[model samples]
Target chain A: MANGSTLLVGIAQGIQRPSALQRMLPSATRRVLNVQLTELEHHGLVSKTIFAELPPRVEYELTDLGRSLLPVIEVMEQWGNTHRTALEQALAGNLAELPN
Target chain B: MANGSTLLVGIAQGIQRPSALQRMLPSATRRVLNVQLTELEHHGLVSKTIFAELPPRVEYELTDLGRSLLPVIEVMEQWGNTHRTALEQALAGNLAELPN
Candidate 1:
């Protein structure tokens, strides 16, 4: 359920429909996606478009501000990939001490 | 508040402490980070380590499964950066029809 906005962005990249998003993510995650989308839309990071039709077709896409975040996201992803092993080790070391 | 896991990862990459995360993000987002960290630890995506001390100290890091996700996160970030303009245009188009 965490990083719902990124998931929404993932959905926008391809998922397209809310129903599809629900199916792709878990139930709790679906709720997170819904909330994130609302916030993203409110922030103008994303926008919803409805085309005229009997059912009223709708789609979500990123906005200018959102686009501006692309570089940052990309850097993060790159960093994640490059440092995966070290990060995992760090996490594992931390987990070893957690109480059951 | 959305994408809290990613934010947490960002924190782990450097933030190191909950307080640092709080200062880096908005208030609502700080709460989300706390929640996401808990879930991440529960799922073994992250682990916490406590050092022995009078006051004690803790740190969070990624796990093996979480490391596996690094490739995915990287791809998403690259995609975001590469497709920034197109995504923005798409989002802009969607926003055009939103009711006030």
Candidate 2:
């Protein structure tokens, strides 16, 4: 996943709790996810709800606009998965036999 | 298109000439397009060819890896077109009534 799309995809896939979201993205530090989540919120893609209960429960849910992104995310994920190997090579400029 | 994908898309749609690619993305200056084309070449997504002819013809073409990105670009463009209004607002953080 690129940009905050991974976090948005995580939120869409029933992982709304912050801790759960963090676990979903093991590579990103908690602080990074927090920052990205904040950006996602600022972008109107997701909404956070805070409860007044003890411990202050908080969860993220996709807004209407955010939900609209799911289809786009779906195709992106599919393409990435399908092209993962070539993509890795492409990013590294490792592929050979191109014209000079 | 995002992250130089517009240029890739332009090339995919048969607009291979540098001048035509610049025309396709009018928002970006010629120099900006050149920079992005360099980046794309660096990333192994595109290849440049120069013809040793009278006018020194040059063109950009997607490598096999780059052509694979077409589906991803298609969906991204679709989503952007569909959400252009909200996305514009979101970028400016001008969204109203987003959770306080």
Candidate 3:
């Protein structure tokens, strides 16, 4: 999955805390993930809450708009999975082996 | 919309020919569009047809799988449109002026 989609799915699936998200998407650089989260927050798709406690708790939750996009994302994911075989072959980038 | 989405929408909307696609998405480099089209075809989302004419003609049509994606694309587009205001503000990147 694309980084953005993965991040959104991670958040939607309850990896709202920053550290948890980092752990969930270990492949994604922390800086890149933070930027994507900020973009998501700025676009009003996700809401960020910061606690004033000593530890400074922070969490992210999908806004109504973000929730609404879940269906679309799900459909896209399904499509990707359904075509995974052909997509992988395509990504392999050796079309000479395609149907002769 | 992202380049991939735009290209898919263009093909879905009958801008099937390469030159026409170029015209429809003028900002997209011809090479990049070709690459995207090839990827779409590779993934089985689109089928290419080449007519054996004196000058040769090529066109693309969404496959059944691709057609199924229309709803997702439509929903995403609708979401983008609905959140255009906030999204534009987000893109502008000046959060200090946000609601106080």
Model 1: per-residue Cα lDDT over A1-100, one tens digit each: 2364455557557776766666666654666767777767755666678889988877778767666665666666666677677767666766786887
1 or 3: which has the higher lDDT? Answer: 3
* Candidate 2: regions farther than 4 A off: A1-3, A92-100, B1-3, B26-32, B53-57, B89-100
- Which lDDT tens digits does candidate 3 get at residues B1-100? 3777777888988989999988877888999889888878876678899999979999999977678778778877887787787677655654765676
TM-score between predicted and true chain B, model 3: 0.86
For the predicted complex of model 2, DockQ is 0.47
Interface RMSD of 1: 8.2
What's the candidate order when arranged by decreasing lDDT?
2, 3, 1
Please report the candidate that would top lDDT against the real structure: 2
Q: Please give the C-alpha DockQ score of model 1.
A: 0.10
Clashing pairs in 2: none
Worst 10 contiguous positions by lDDT, candidate 1 chain B: B1-10
- Candidates 1 and 3 compared: the better one by DockQ is 3
**TM-score for each of the candidates:** 0.49, 0.77, 0.77
- Docking quality of model 1: it rates as incorrect
